[model samples]
Target: MGQKLIVGISDWKIGRGDDVLVTYALGSCIGTCLYDRTTGISGLSHIMLPDSTAIIDGHTTRMKFADTALPDMLEKMKAMGAMQGAIKAKIAGGAIMFQTSNSKFNIGQRNIEAVKAALQKLRIPIIAEDTGLNYGRTMTFWAENGAVEISSTVMGKKMI
Candidate 1:
């Protein structure tokens, strides 16, 4: 199959062939990559926040927050015939963009911690990550080959 590319904020794309899911400019945000090698089905979520509790109703889009989006992404993959046990995860793009005196509103740190906590709760192991930096990032997940590439204006592109 030919290559398929997807791009945006708070978006996710799943692939079973030669498709790539990519998100750019991840600053004070996080991206999660989920892949099932056996089925060659992979997914990625670009989340801007840790939780959606303040949003109320609890019925926003499934990609809105890390706490909700991660689990939902896994479920979607499983429904598409991806085996739970075969799924591997990679995370990136949690940067403390600005130096601040107060730590309470450290969105980047909160985002990273929240993602780790959510993954732990789901019993999914994080095989790799490039987080907690002070820069922005662009992440590309090549589902066809189970490859995840990360790029930053300061760091350039590198495999994670």
Candidate 2:
């Protein structure tokens, strides 16, 4: 019961001790959680898109894309005394949410791929994940234990 931080779409937050991080209504978006067990420090990132390079405009929301956001989050975590080698990842969301006539419109799958690639590039292993389905999700990340709780109206709740 230390603190409850609400991470909005295209945002990230870091917490420690008994703090909890939460994000809501993840449809095509992805929620990535990174934690260092030694320090009890945790970070949660909610990204809306796969890559920022796809944006034609020079202006891009850094936290809205997996390619940019994950690295940035890791840097911030390092500033908080989290070690790169000790960090582990847990992910949730990236649901199709609705039927699409074309595969290119399936942003959920693209997001899932992008997130995995980004995490791989960061050298952070994904310990668990609950992703890729037809329903939206909400995530509650507990900093004390580095547990991510995935919740959906259709599927109830589960910890990953």
Candidate 3:
């Protein structure tokens, strides 16, 4: 019932009231949403890469990579009274961005794949997804209703 707030890259938001959390312009990066219906608690993470093996230091940042951030995000949510078994997930982003000749630079695809593998490993079922495309997306998560919405210049806005 309040104004929606925009969460940028590498940002995560959690809420228990009527506020809606949103992010924009997701190309290769991934946006993940976790919601607990019973508690009306919701959280979202925007991740850039799949793994952090390439980083020199072991320190992790919110926007750095999914391999490190996803686990941390889940842990934080659990601390906020979100039940693991009761948490439902929705993911978006992972666009091709541009036609790249080199495979190493395909960060978007790698990010998406990493998120999927992580979720599977955690035994969390992904209720919905909008990934692997050629355009950027804007994603929103409503904590009050547990609804995830996605929008794009090419696809417009729709609930996922």
Point to the candidate with the largest lDDT.
2
Candidate 3 RMSD computed on C-alpha atoms after optimal superposition onto the true structure? 1.6
Report the lDDT tens digits of candidate 1 across residue range 1-160.
7466665677776777888888888888898998898999898888888987778785567586898888988888999999988888999988988888989768998999999999999888899999986999988888887798899888788999
lDDT of 2 by residue, 22-91 (tens): 9998999999999999998899999999999978886767999999999999999999899999999999
Error of 2 at 39 (Å): 0.4
Model 3 C-alpha lDDT per residue in residues 37-153, reported as the tens digit of each score = 888778888888898877887565745678777788788888988888988899999988998899888888888889998888877789999999699999989998889889999
Ranking by TM-score: 2, 1, 3
**Candidate 1 residue pairs in backbone clash:** none
**Predicted structure 2: lDDT:** 0.94
State, as a TM-score between 0 and 1, how close model 2 is to the true structure. 0.97
Clashes of 1: 0
Worst 10-residue lDDT window, candidate 1: 1-10
User: After TM-score superposition, what is the CA distance of residue 12 in candidate 3 from its true location, in Å?
Assistant: 1.1
